[model samples]
Target chain A: MKHAVSHIIPNLTTLTASQTLFDMVPLFREIYAFRDLLWILVGKNIKIRYKRSALGFLWTFLNPVFMIIIYSIFLKILLSFDARDPLFLQRLVTGILVWQFLAMCVGDSLHAVLGNASLVKKTSFPRIILPLSTVLANFVNFAITLPILVVFLFVNGTTLGDMWLLPLVIASQFALCLGVSLILSCMNVFFRDTEHLMSAVMLAWFFLSPIIYPFSKIPEAFQRLALLNPMCGIVTAYRTAFLGTDLMAPRLVVISLLMSWLILALGVSLFQRWQVNFGDKL
Target chain B: MTTPAPIIDVRNVSKRFSLQQQRGETTIKAIVVDALRGHGKRRDFWALRDVNVAVQQGETVGIIGSNGAGKSTLLSLISQTSQPTSGTITTRGKVSSLLELGAGFHPDLTGRENVFLYGAIMGLSHRQMAERFDQIVAFAELAEWIDEPVKHYSSGMYVRLAFSVAVEVDPDILIIDEVLAVGDASFQRKCIARIDAFKQAGKTLLVVSHDLNTVHTISDQLILMEKGQIIATGDPDAVVAQYQWLSRETACTAETKEWGTGAVKIKAARFLDAEGQEAEELQRGMPVRIEIGYEASRRIDAPVFGFSIQTTSGILVYGNNTQIEEFDLPFIEGKGTITLDFSALELLAGAYLFSFSVHSQDHQTNYHRLDNGHPITVRSERRYEGVCHMPVRWSVGKGK
Candidate 1:
């Protein structure tokens, strides 16, 4: 009797034996449907940052200011180069602010999925929100600190021109940080060593970028290879917008933009492939 | 007109997990070497295999099984917390699962903030959650601590708040896995009543529970699973009977060794009905007779014959001895039968093990003892929510 009844119930829900490349699109659409969840998580991340702090949101501005003072003292006063040039201070502040944003985003993203193992195991939502929210939280921090950059630029007597282009540069940097964050976060879920590796890599990437030192300081021979680092083009564009430096090389900006999109595609694809196994792995 | 589809249609679903034996394999060097060699040892085990279940709208289906029976795996698959390795699960409604209470709660966040955060995680908008926020807090009875961080709330308060938010979302299908086992008894009763109301409002419910009575009472249909397979699926009483019989058989087979000094011995033990006919299963809240046959090789003074009814987990539900009951047995030399009769066995629907023993007056020396001697399967006529059913009456009226 049981066998007869079992046979009568048709298998209406059938899963494919294997996944195809086209499956990526539907997975993205699923994540898109849960965008509101991403925003809530981002809000949670930002709220927790200042939850118990005494200075609260002021720390966001104070952090960049402190880093600028320390770097300027060490690089300009001790090293005794360009101590009076306002452009040097303007360049350093803008570069540090952007670099701090990327560092925090990457550092936090490394633990995004691993840190939320409880939620991943018990709840059903878009898993990508875990990493995306971490990136966005850092983005909110960067926005909070932007006023400090404006104050520094104003104090240095620097004026902005064609400021509309600034959003493009910021957008490219956002995409770049988000892409790298996605890859690191997803990989960290499997290989916990990825987080430590990222800290070291971010340190090296920071010094290699023109954050503390001017891009022109690097000998012209290594300039092309330096531009290969997406942050190089992004920081150069920020300097061009604020300090009125020469425009970034068109080829370098294009290369950075292409790299951002490519990394995003790669990160997303890798994330989707490993996500089905995340619940069990965690 | 076309027939409406079931709220959840799970077809031939199976989930397999690969167990990594080598801790070294997690390291980069080991993984690199294994990849280069193109060979890695993988041991995979299936938690569920080809399990088929369809939950129509307004149906409450309970899944009951022993530990490691893939009950949670089935629930996880249905809830979409985890995907099956094979087959497909099609859910046609907003499915909310309370797989674990306070699963996504942030300890640092206040209860009010967590409500919005959890609501958003469950796909409710900030505006929608704001509208339901008061209702959720009121239902949880946690208005006093709603602004305090969840870390300060007791475990019971945490569960109450989490359960309130989950149920208040008004999901079309609700999948719960043993979350009601927490909280105080009154709160549990309230949660169960809320679930009952959900059923009345035509919501599909898939519940997994080790509490046999709760499942038997709540589920319109029951699915009995064993070792990743659905062994039986039908009426709650009949399925529970099958589960009890199987559990008893397995328990008895594992403990076959018996030891005694043989001054006095329990020869046989069996359950009997009112007509004195041998019966392996009895209806709950009905008369039950456990007849124990014994013999004595030599004369013994004041021998105490007793029996205990225990769930398979060895929880002593009820037990009684002739000596404790003050039924003085003077002496015994030869074959005799000890009869224990209960007017109504108040056991809920489940399997129970019967252990019969004979001991001397001081209860220090055991003449003979049979552990897990027999199994009694009880089929309850009415739904209950605990280990044993208590006879009671209910009245409802407005207090003037």
Candidate 2:
């Protein structure tokens, strides 16, 4: 009976692919089975990215410092925003540091799946591992940049309030970025237009979120609509935890937490469903 | 005893590729094409069609096919790199596939770094890679350059490292494409020995190679594919014979053919360079040598060895003989060599077929004649055009 059935179907290649697309249990299991690959890819990404530079991974922290100085000069001198505003630097630093993880992951993973099409064409493993590792590597960089926020908090004379909730905020943002990265990267393999359109969309997303601008400045109606962008709630959460700012529409945090995971699940499902044909396309 | 469920089972597998969208089209260009063509033409390309096969454990199956016959596609399906458009392929045990040269290696990373990275990509644990790291470096003979970036390594070195990693990982089923031909003779021999060990073990192996002799000897079972379908299967010798017959029926192209009498025999002939390195390719204006190794079964009097260079279209470019050059050997016995040396090969950038023959100085008795139409490519950097390069100097001042 086993011999007859083996002729009918075959081994793990067909067995794993036989599962329904919605049955993500196999995917998660494969991910767990290939966890070492994820870590190594993450390590590889980091080393290849930074090894050529003289400073070597120090740029993770140094990046935010450079941005902070440029933004300070742009806002205070060029825009003539009052330097007397204490909370301004705190808001800027929190927003930029948190936002960097999302930008970097989306950018890197944009090419992660497509750039490694040669590997994809030859080898078979969980395709999700590519984007997952990219996001995790950027998260490591995000962790490294957090100290810059600590220095900024001191400079602003802001005592950390509700600081423990920062982990939840980080988790929410990670899910959102991973989801977006996965979608963009997967689509980039097929359409390639996704990569070009993504840059424009990200620019719009950055301004829509209250990174440099304060949330209170927006009109009430626009503020409610802006909350639909998960980064709005995410950036606000960072400011709330660090600078003791009011969490406008307190459910925004919960929305962020829920919406990000929703997108992440959607991204994972679509990617797996479509990846069966990825090798053919590549 | 039951045959352990046939380790690999591929059933009625067919892969279809759509022709609507050209592959590797840039997004902007794709969008433009979409707007311009607007689904003007639609056709589906069948890369594989109703291919089926089953193999027991410890079996070595060699797949032979002309280009684009879907041999690579079938291997991809078995390795689970791509799913078939229809049908199912089941492969048991750990399947390690070496599909192409320089598989997924980061060109910027050092050889040491890429080894670890590639191990992980092949789903090997860090500990496994670490354990075999030394052996991989040693087997590839790249210990001296392991720390150097792989981009700097030659193609031969790159293939050596990749082959070492795949073999050392001890996979249950090994699938190799045509990467084996890249390494030098000794490295190739070392790899063949390791592969022989794999065969000695109970592991399954699938090899795809254009070198019919290697495949015939290495594989006990052979699969011959044509036009995305299996045309022949079973014993390697029979299948290879069928493949040869079929190709002969289809293509009446002549290759190296030699006819000789019983006196003298030409054993081997090869092209060499000034440094005595065996030459695969040559550059214009480089010193070249054509050495013919011959054996006289019995004493032969006044045998003349001749060499000819011809264009692929059968146009003879140069022909010379020992008798014509007035270089004579009274008699030759046992084994000896006839060397044709060129201070500078003046042929331009193109391919040429070589011919070697031996006969009596009187041209009455033909001991051997060989028309070797195997094309050898000649390269040149200078922009001199035509079938031959001539040294020239230019003085452009008219008043002078």
For model 2, residues B1-400, the per-residue Cα lDDT tens digits are: 6666778899888887777543554467666776787765545788899989998899999999777888998888887888787787777767778886645566777888878877776667778789999999999999999999888999999889878877876677899998787889898889889999999988899999876767877998999999999999998766865665455323223366778795888877778876888875777899998778899998999899998877544567788999889997899999999888889999875556777889998788888888753456676666454667778888888785
Q: What is the TM-score of chain B alone in each candidate?
A: 0.80, 0.63
Q: Which runs in model 1 stand beyond 4 Å of their true positions?
A: A1-32, A83-87, A159-164, A246-248, B1-3, B21-25, B29-40, B249-302, B311-349, B367-369, B378-400
TM-score computed on alpha carbons, candidate 1: 0.85
At residue B133, give the lDDT of candidate 2: 98
Q: After superposition, how far is residue B359 of candidate 1 from its true place, in Å?
A: 2.3
Q: Write the per-residue lDDT of candidate 1 for residues A34-86, one digit (tens) a residue.
A: 76678878888887788889998777778888877787688767876565654
Q: Could you tell me which residue pairs clash in candidate 1?
A: none
lDDT of 2 by residue, A20-98 (tens): 4546776776787678778977887887788779998888878888987887788767876565665776687788888
- DockQ of all candidates, in order? 0.27, 0.24
Tens digits of per-residue lDDT for model 1, B265-349: 8888768876778898888877878778899999999999888777776778888899899999999999989888989889987
